[model samples]
Target chain A: MGVTGRAKRGKTEGPILKKCSTGIKGLDEITGGGLPQGRPTLVCGGTGCGKTLLAMEFLLRGALNYGEPGVFMSFEEKPDELVQNYASLGFDLEGLVAQHRLVLEYVYIERSEIEETGEYDLEALFIRLGHAIDSIGAKRVVLDTVEALFSGFSNESILRAELRRLFRFLKSKGVTAIITGEQGERTLTRYGLEEYVADCVIFLNHTVSDQIATRHLRIIKYRGSSHGTNEYPFLIDQQGFSVMPITSLGLDHPAFTERISTGIPRLDTMLGGEGYFRGSSILVSGTAGTGKSSMAAHFVDGACSRGERCLYFAFEESQNQIIRNMRSIGIDLEQWVKKGLLRFHNTRPSLYGLEMHLVALHKEVERFDPAVVVVDPISNLVTAAAPKEVKAMLSRLIDYLKLKRITAFCTDLTSAGGGILEQTEVGVSSLMDAWLLLQNIEGSGERNRGLYILKARGIAHSNQIREFFLTDRGIALRDVYVGPGGVLTGTARIAQEARDAAASTLHRQEIERKQRELERKKKTVDAQIIALKTEYELEREELQQAVAQERLRDDVVMKESMEMARARQADAVPTTAGGKQGRGGRKR
Target chain B: MIAAEGKRVHNGDGEQWILRLYVAGQTPKCLTAFANLKKICEEHLAGQYRIEIIDLLVHPELAKGDQILALPTLVRKLPEPVKKIIGDLSNTEKVLVGLDIRPFK
Candidate 1:
């Protein structure tokens, strides 16, 4: 249908259902275009649901923006009342009327003041509306609360017939009209005016869930056109109605390979040595006092330092408070704010409804056109809305930022309960492209911060849980040490290191003492050997002396014996003695 | 055309009754309402009555003065208190009661 419509429009094939722009922010996109041209659209809703305002804005926009004259014929409110009411919203209705671009007509109907005596028709009404439209050459018309005629007339048949004719008359006049009706219990309108204006029908609903009021707009039917069927949340403030069709921003946002820093260099090293993708959404979740906000502030500071605009949404703390707290951590955000690179929007989550908060965020982001956005502690928003609602709102925010190619840095505060510490209370973790989980590591009577990358799509991130610290200069990430018990951090690791050093020193001292004692013992044994050698030498000398003396005496004795032997007994005995002596020498 | 009969009087104080009839054009409903109003005035108010006819098609801006929305509407403009009766004045009794020609007691 979209293709055919575009093709027909491109060819200008004899007015193929030309669209009239509604001039409402985000509404035209939802309706594929605006309402069908030269046809009447029925806007029905319950009382106090902004039906009249929507109709008024449509006509006002037609006159002011499109340069097409409009006629506003109200049956419920007088022209002056409407002028006064719209003046607060910065819409100069009276000025438009003075410029001859708009016509305001009030149709007064009082059943008690008139008595019907015979058959009649609503010819005066038709003439009045036609005259008003013709007076200004109006291209747009708004009959706010036309259902007032139902209560003013007694004949339903005549009123219904006249209404049907009115719609036809409006169509014949080629004026795009918005006819508002009060919502009925069963039908879309009280008098079933939807049955007449069947070309397009839009329904506005105001509902209060958990004491928070939210307004929604839904296109019920649009003939010959395709429209978004989802109920979009709309906001009406000082500005006019703004519809947020977040679902329209599917997952088609451009994926950028450009990487931006997380401010802390070590943390960036943990995330593939670069940082989060330029348009990616990063979630920093942790328990209280785990430096989540500090981490986010670092991100904002990094973006600001790079000369890019950053918008910080502080839900729990005021601007001054955040500045003061961040200053303690050596992050001077005040200077960035002064330089117009960083903007701080501080509001309590309970100040407005969830949808209102979302709308405010949208407005601020649009105005600032920042390159990065930070929502410090999104968990506080859960108090204003249900967790499911918070998730939906965050997803919309993330999608909007992603579509704008703006990096979003959000902090989540998890409760210190038995629940999984890795999980966020708002459950927006799944929507984030990079998730950094901060935890409190309590051991050895001290609590220390630890940070780890839970998941980072399309990046090879470290799986180690690095010990996180908020130093006086900035954030510091150090590798946690593995002890005999488990991974150690803080004072426990310090103590273990000290103990290891002392034990190594003691072992070195003991080895030195043992070496000295062994050297002394070896010296003592050498001395003993020296003394024994000296004693042996002395003994040998004494033996030599004794042996010489003995030899002399033996020689002398032998000579005497030889003489005696020679004298008396035997030359044979002398020869035997000489051989024995030679033998003895050989043995020695 | 306006019809004026101010010479004859047949009511207390002889106060003149000024009746204005509003119509978009010369439709049958306008003719019937004019005829019925004339007959009733001749019988009840006599010469102390004046009927003015206004055609909205000629002067559409005049509709805002009387807050006129219905066709053939009769507005009693000069009876100290204004009274409006819509539709063609074919029912005489209801018209009398509506215009206070004969108050319902």
Candidate 2:
């Protein structure tokens, strides 16, 4: 029982206290693994705050779940009434009694019946509790509303001393115990039983705000162990009491490097080449009728197509309503629902408080163990809870899903505004790994849906605002870059594209006319060149013929002169033997 | 409680007062409370009251029906509005005022 080193940050990870699980949801975690093992813990609350139920569940869970028999000394309720009350929670108290594993003894302490004849200690109570424990070999005990015995007292000191002795006796018996007390006007308990059972003190409070009754539990103090020091919301349903502790526990969840498809292929294109990171949280913030639910349905459809289990939590629409609405957009969730691969938990936010919603969602997610979870419009939770509560719930939920490596998509509904990325109620943008903003682009006499990725961790995403139209096949992203600065969408984009096509066609026709004129000029040039070459060839041929004729005339003239001069020299010189022979041959 | 009617109408017109004394196993305080209640009734409503004593030790379930948290309590059952006087009825003046009993005027 001495001081330890480095206990401030609670780094000593082994069993710090010999603890046992309360078997109450989230209570063990808040209690640093449950109430101290063999010590009595005081449970005090006002009337009808479920003090008895909490104590009874502790004993019952000890008996049934941990194989630890327990004895219940009810100062208020009878054994039969207890059995009846717990029967609804599926606790078979009678069966345990019949087996002699659980002993439920109702000690009637009538105030007016017994006069304090003398100084009487609660030694008789210790005897009865001891006998019950020995009879059942019990390891746990409960004294419900120990303050009931105080009514018959005339002296406060005697009552206080007896109460102190009773706790000491119970502790000496070496059995983990629970003692319930009614809340005082301003004190911890009616009799200050807290001072007696100082090992652990759990306080249950019932508060009504805004016409809603919310039950909360807090561990006022627990000695020798570090406990969660915050008020946690608890619910007492047919299964009995369950506490919800929205704790972060220092953010120790594993991360994944894998990617998953975002349903719409074009949306996937916007999110790098693959899609969102596996086990990452995505926020799709949008205004009314901005196709947020449709996007969620498409995500579910994509998950189902991959044969991964998916759960969709819808706050605004019913299961059949969403199924029918998605059918129009070519995303069929009904078939997956039938196939048992998809589950829809549709509930109204006003039906329960935010903590209850968180508890219900936690239960379903644990039960279904889905690979992907989609919450359509988490703004309902934001609307139903305070800002701090919503943030805490979101952080815890994100941590839980990250631990399970589940891809979660949450849609936040922003008010109808002129710009995207408007201030949301929960302000959970920092908790998300990827965020997509969907907006209504109302201009040029039409309302068009625009989508853009605000940020995606570990992936390079498109910075362009994609104008997507929901078609019968699915969502189709249009080529919206009309020009360097003009970003058109919807019908406006279609008109602008058509006009651009006409202008480009006109430009193309002018280029074609110039090409045709160049071809005609080239044809005329070729025809003229051919005519000049033909004329040149004809003239060259005449010149060559003239030269040949001139040569022949010169020869003939020379021959005539020679013939005249040499008529007698017939012979003339010129006509030698070869010439004469040639003349003769020509004459012949 | 009457079965045929949705609500029971208590008879408050000059009727005898029906009272119950809850005790535990013949204790001294139980005897004292019984004696005190009878003395008061005889003095104020002589021959016009009836007293029933219930030992919680023998029948503890009866305590639940009466919402009895303290022992030796005096319950004025049938005087229109039921009244409870806790403790051993030691204060006669307080018990008379709690039971709303006046002398025959």
Candidate 3:
């Protein structure tokens, strides 16, 4: 009796914010660290976009990962069929049920068999759901496509009213819920139920363009919190749907305190004093056929030689092709691949959406835990996405790499005649820590390749454009050579050399022409100087005559002043006394 | 054993008996009856009698399996079929009639 009273008090307190961990990878991030505890999140999507899978993953992960009991109310799928569908994904639904941690209720309603029983008020459904949830103490609830009730009943008004009431009832009871709805061709939800009664709405889209299907999920609205707004592409496989948030990681990753070599001595010299920080991003841009792949291969081999894992994602070459090609250049990728230190994921750039490629990259990176990640040519990825999308994906990739403290090397293929210094395909060149530009310069009737360090963020890098050659010994960089012209590319350097020679010949002709013009100007100045000197002497003689006339007038004035001064001295005595008396009277 | 007016005979040898149970109709109150007697008879007397099921609507004289105080009654007549049960055979003694038990003696 004592315990009974306390238990009653607990029940009246209602459900606290019950949280269900969505088993979906990266989904929790978009959900502001999972759906509001005990509140229903409406998941609406078109057919085959993994709406049900998402709901099931939420329930499964709740039971498996978080020790929270769950209830799945399926109106569309039978319990057995639902279990079978998730079996391939390694979710043991039956085991969870047997252990009493999960409950699944299959509500079968045949519309034809149903009579106009106005007395039925979904009381039976409430009883069934209530029993299932209470029986398992379920903290998570999933109503899989509850819209089936609309099919069973003809009255839309009653269905809407009841659905709202049901959501309110579940909320009042305090169960964290996920309610899935079908998506209409033009509407966010088939029944538009998602527009009402739910606290959150997520839209799942399966878009096919150019014969490639990609699944994208966007949080349409989340009340009381902030979430990522971009349409993040996800993958549906044996492990269920995994949402790859294109910008989940921000730019505030911890900088690596230690430095690591780039595996090439010359390349390392270009990166600061010796090497780059372990987790920094390196951008290598060049025109076609400038050995970008070779540089990446060298990095991969470098990481492998240090007994560290390296992941190479070659968008334009197969693993075997890359390994074989690199072997000829003395970069033995095959040996590293055999040692399990090197993992190669080579696929076409157009194989999937930008987000799908990112998800695949993320999955491999997570599984391998590699020290370095090499994208042979990230430029090819731009073709599959818009410039903005490519930027978002690359930002996410770089952020995730920094979080794992993994060095990332990305190669970009610039177009010919576009100049040596070109922006990256995604416009993320500013985000890179070290940027390297490779070009083919033509010099002395031959094309020589040059590599230069554009910017290294945190360290001093070699500014010299060093001459590099792909020989039998691998990538060897010759010392900085100051040739006739500036740094060279294969054909451009030779063209510049010829242009410089022609410029020198034209300079000599111009000097001789200037000397002849100077001689003519000097003779003209001599004649003008003699004419000006004669005019100067005549002007001086006229100025002297004027000066003599003014001097004669000054002599007559001085003689008159001397006679006046002698008369003033004879009357000086009496004048001085009179002047003193006048001064005293004026003062009084 | 002699046969006289109202005389009865007791035989040590097990012999087959004929019994009948009656009911007014398939009313809810009268439905428990035939099943009750058949179950008792099968358990006590297996392979001993050929039970005849009779309805009074067809033959009123064979208000058998017991005395007819209610719609459902029972009467036994073989081995002199023995006695009759009345009032829907709600009593156990009235059901012993088909087993040849004389409660009056």
Per-residue CA lDDT of model 3 for A38-91, tens digit only, reads 678999998989889888888888898889899998888988998898888988
Best by lDDT: 1
TM-score of chain B of 1: 0.84
RMSD of 2: 12.5
DockQ score, prediction 1: 0.58
TM-score of each: 0.83, 0.72, 0.65
Query: How do the residues B1-105 of candidate 3 rate in per-residue lDDT, one tens digit apiece?
Result: 113211332332344566665554454434566666677666655455556665554444333113232244455666562454433344445455324442433
Candidate 1 — which residues are off by over 4 angstroms? A1-15, A482-486, A496-588, B1-15
- The TM-score that candidate 2 achieves is 0.72
Residue lDDT tens for model 2, A1-588 = 234555643545755668868798789989878889889999999999989999999999998889999999887788899999899999999999998879997877655444333223343455566667877898899999888787755667867887787788888888899999999998989888888999999999988765556788999989988888888888887778888776725577777889999998888888888999999999999898888888888889999999999989989999999988889989888899999999999998878877778778888999999999998888888666677777877877888888889999999988775464555558888999999988887767888888988899998999988888888777777656545545677778887888889999999999999999999999999999999999999999999999899768766865886677677665436455645665567547
TM-score of chain B of 2: 0.81
Minimum summed lDDT over a 10-residue window in model 2 chain A is located at: A114-123
Per-model chain B TM-scores are 0.84, 0.81, 0.59
Q: Model 3, stretches more than 4 Å misplaced?
A: A1-18, A117-120, A184-187, A383-387, A417-421, A443-446, A479-588, B1-105
A best-first ranking of the candidates according to their DockQ comes to 1, 2, 3
- How far residue A547's Cα lies from its native spot in candidate 2, in Å, is 31
Best candidate, TM-score = 1
